[model samples]
Target: MTTERRVLVYGANGYTGKIVSESLANRGIPHYFAGRNREKLEAALSIVAERFGSPVDAEIAVASNNPDELRPLFAKVDVVINVAGPFMQMAWPVVETALECGCHYTDTTGEQDWSRAIAEQYGQAFADKGLLLAPATSYMWSAGALAAEIVLENKGVDSLDIIYQIDRGLPSEASTKSFLRMVCNDQLYLDLNEYAAWDWDTLVDVHVPYRGASIRAFPWGGACEPIWYKDDPRVLNCKVLTAMGEHLIDGVKMAIDKFHEEALSLSQEEREAWTNTVGDTMHQGEPPKDNVTAQRSCIIVGGQGQTTTVQYVMNLSAPYTWTGEVSAEAAKQLLAGKLLKPGFQSVATAFNHRELLQTFHELGFTSAPPAPGTL
Candidate 1:
């Protein structure tokens, strides 16, 4: 192991990637801003320098998942925070290369299928090498898992109901692409300790504590929690539901339901091609600064056991900003030699919940006191 630890932020030119890079720069964490385009990476670095009011003294590397090209970059870095998404199409090669180079791997993926693939296929390999393979380390899944862990508190909760709500704000182009990809894929949830296909038509009404209204939410796969809590004997069921602003729910659902039907009618190859074209066209540039500054996100977890139930809520501003904060912090912990047992881990599994929550609290995130609650 190198005495001095270093990190590389791959896909540093994307909207979320730029935020992650800026977070690391603000913390004075030395990292290489890396991506396939040198020009874009340089442009992102310039913005970071200006925003942080100090030039980031970091190297810029042009590389992708091409092993011969990426191996050298991976060899020099102790950790890689991959913000690139629709991770299903992009994560495999990058992860494979990271493990081959003996570097810790983490990403901001919320895709259930891809996360499970990493855990099942490469978990053991990473464990054997004593390296961490944590995916979904950003706001989407990691924050939810953290909230679940906090509420469970080893209470032996056997079921989890997770809900995510965000105020009206623009999602990054990468996030929109990921959503497009997800719409065409089969969704899964955990039941009785086994994975089952989710019924997209089954929408449940959830009362949003932040918004103070009930919104209908469909089963959004099991997300990363089912994968994280899969083998844990203490948990037997996990379900995740997500919604945007209440006013937008019906329109978004109608669009998604329509797309899902059309996508499922085609062959796998056709679906992939169609989704890519749609994703490209739907991809908007970076969100406006004012939108990000004014938006807020929430994650609510309802944990139930044979005899007990608890609900926990977390509220944070600027989903993209929080994603950047959490990703940068995870990288910092890994670079500082914090070792996890490896094997496809969630943020909670890889790091201390209290420590992570403390960091978030310090960053202005608020958590509601746990108590008996409805929805």
Candidate 2:
């Protein structure tokens, strides 16, 4: 990518946004910060300068929901790395503004409904403009999707079972709010190449090698993989399952069940208010700790067909840190004209899967053996 290309980190003041900004700075990518708070944006820039020993390009106070405030800056930028969360509520306007300004778009969203909506509603628009709309390029989903792509490379591998297990780390307030908003309804997955609903109350016992046995996992939001693979002609079935940790799985499941149960009687507005209330109680405005030393997570994707079976694994630590690096790398690749096609995409579909895996490998994100079809 050209060093002269401009990138804008929207929501630059948020917990994850600062990490993304740091990644961009480390890569020497030219970028600026934009957010609704002038003080927070300035503070973010100061943090970057203090950490890197050099000041960032600039910081602009712009309201994300205000198209008037966004249009000018977006029109000037080559790419927009949106770190804003609870994307279902805050992402559309930015996505619209990016397409209007002809800038590529990507975000750290794990909301399945949001991804499906973006693809169904705006996918064609982005393609028409030759721009991209890659959502959920974060660890929760994209990392596992990468593993699925690796397994798919093996011929005759049709169905996929993906799992995400996080053994440590606490949630940020924004992330907690996003989770509360999403778990209030059933999540959908691709079943035999068709949409299938996942009842929020059930859990699946699946094998996780790290655990050396089966562990209970939920189809948390069904993730973005099924959506990414829904239209691909590859073999049929896909299901995604995840768990915070064995210790917390039951509690997490109970909370989800409670939300879904209570939401049945509540109006839409009331459900939202209830979600905010519970989310605030759970997180209490705490910034998540980057405890890589204690962080133990696994993204396991396995594919089974009549005559073939394949599995790919990714052991992770501090996934939020990985999210930051992945966002910056994706923006760089897009600016370098490395995308497979425009419009709604997952990481594997949007860019070369192996190339991305290699990038992560070099950065210490992957410790597994080479994928079945790779050299």
Candidate 3:
């Protein structure tokens, strides 16, 4: 790795991509901002120039998944923070190119199946390459969950519940479309469908005193957390409750059901194509409605021996924003001679929580109880 931290942000023209660029600029880090859009990249460069006075020593490149363009991107920087996703369809090629060029790879991928795919298909190769590969270090899966791990070790926490709620901000239609495309990929939907197929009810009433009298919460996509809670049977269960309004959830459910009724007869390939077209076409706008103001963040685990029950919120709504930032930071760590050992990694896995939390805290997030947990 180069001694100086120079990064190529692969999805720099996205909604969250702008935020990543801002964070990197504010850090005084030299970055090569790139994306598939030449016009969009130019526009972002204008904004950056207006703020930071023309990058101080930065260059901009336009790139896509194509090797002719992507290969050059890899050679230009010590790392690539892939902010482009729903990563299930996109991970392998970008990761493959990065690995081939001997560059570190970091992304904000959260789909569990994708993780399984990586482990089964490429884990051994990544370890042998002695390259740092990290994934899922954002709002949904990494940071918040990592914090829960920290709080769990604090003693006296009988039952633990992490309630994640997104109250206001609407996701960009592009993100929504990508998410749908990922869902359309059959393997992505299989496990969730099978679990929901049983119509099994596996949640309980939680009274998070800090949030309110009580809120209905459930396990987050059936993720297993007992590994961290295994020592104490008293711990009961640790669940991530995606607590949003019932009306909203029910309304979305109806729309999904109607779509399914219309789509039940297509072959697998046809279904994929239709899903991509329809998803992209339907969600093509900023969808500009009321307040873009949104609340997004992971809640910490709270219970008896874990005496503190709480709720937290983050400003992030786009997955790429988190991925690009953390990945850039991880790359910088390598450049600074602070590189963590290679082989599969997450942003949190490569660094301590204190540094991560401190960086995020500066980004407008506030931890519950105000004191902030240790990294």
Candidate 4:
């Protein structure tokens, strides 16, 4: 609520975090860069400065989720864009501190369970405090949700089938870890406006409009669009399915089966711990940089009603860059007091969807033909 609207980018040293930092820097927004590693944060600061050709007039803070350590830092910022991942494992302390310090919180999380948890456990608290808790504001989930919302604007479109297909790019270390942890169990989707378990074993065959071919995809730990629209009177059924290459999907299925077999006897809590340990060994290195073509993605959202069925196809490149752009922009919106509501919200709900989509177009993420309904 301060006039200056100070900002903080938590996890500002990680892969996607650095991208978020870069976006913020590109906007010429002065903010603090914070993470557990001061050395990495310092390195990220240098990168941002070098890229922008201007010294970012910002301080760097070293802190973890420990409230005593985080409170002072959180107090100094009006908004926190948390890019740290595997949110189910590491998000609580940061969330608690953000709430305690009266800061608006947003993160790049596609984990449906965690988003639902935020809504169920702390949605009212955030609303009561008149603070915003907008999770899953990144490319994975939010991008599709925004497209779904756009289609929903057409009258009588209620049921949404959201599918995300990334044609390229290697998953970052953090993303690989999160995916492994998420795919360890079944996910939830909306049926008759109620949450129902989606079997981890099932892979749905999704037709990619751009590719003009059907590919195997699954609700990779479920999509949060259903959760986001759970209370909306407009939606009755929602399911989200996603896939990379067919080979990658096959590998993921194999990993899921393997994990289930190995962790069959372990408690859910124990499985959570197990996934973390297993994820650490899977991918550990820097992701490819400035590879927009390799990071291309497509979103297919079809809305079905009693008699009408309309599908929208959007193609975009550079998923990670889009994440950074959107997250940084969301932080600015929060700082400017531009929010839809206080409680747990998606990017579409938190901002004007038309404006948001226009931003997407302005970012050069949107492409032509098939347009909206031609497909």
Tens-place lDDT digits, model 3, residues 307-346: 4553333333333345445655666676675656566655
Model-by-model lDDT, in order? 0.78, 0.81, 0.55, 0.81
In model 4, which regions exceed 4 Å deviation? 1-5, 368-375
For model 1, residues 1-375, the per-residue Cα lDDT tens digits are 233538988888888887888888767788888899989998988988887788875689999767888889999888889988778888788999999999889999878888888888999999889888998888778888888877778465789989987777566777776766664577787889898877666567888885556877755544788888887887899888887566556654665676776776888678767777776776566776423456777788888998888777887677777888889888888877675566578878788777878877777754543333332
Which digits, one per residue and each the tens of the lDDT, describe model 4 over residues 1-375? 233538888888888887888788777677888889899899988887786687876689999867899899999887888888789888898899999999889999878888898889998899899888888888878888888877887777889998898876567777877887777766888899998998768788878885777888878878789889997899999998888766477767877888988986899888887777776776657765544666778888999988788888878678888888888888877767788888888878888876777776877875543334443
Q: Which of the numbered candidates is closest to the native, going by highest lDDT?
A: 4
Residue 82, model 1: lDDT of 91
**CA lDDT of 132 in candidate 1?**
89
Per-residue lDDT of model 2, residues 90-149, tens digit only: 888898899999989989987888889989999999999888888987887788888887
Instruction: Please list the residue runs of candidate 1 whose C-alpha ends up more than 4 Å from where it truly belongs after superposition.
Output: 1-5, 289-293, 368-375
lDDT comparing candidate 3 with the true structure: 0.55
Which of candidates 1 and 2 is the stronger one according to TM-score?
2
The window of 10 residues in a row where model 2 has the poorest summed lDDT is: 366-375
TM-score of model 2 vs. true structure: 0.94
Q: Against the hidden true structure, what lDDT does model 4 obtain?
A: 0.81
C-alpha displacement of 112 in model 1, angstroms? 0.9
Worst 10-residue lDDT window, candidate 1: 366-375
| Model 4 error, position 151 (Å) | 0.9
Order the candidate numbers by lDDT, best to worst: 4, 2, 1, 3
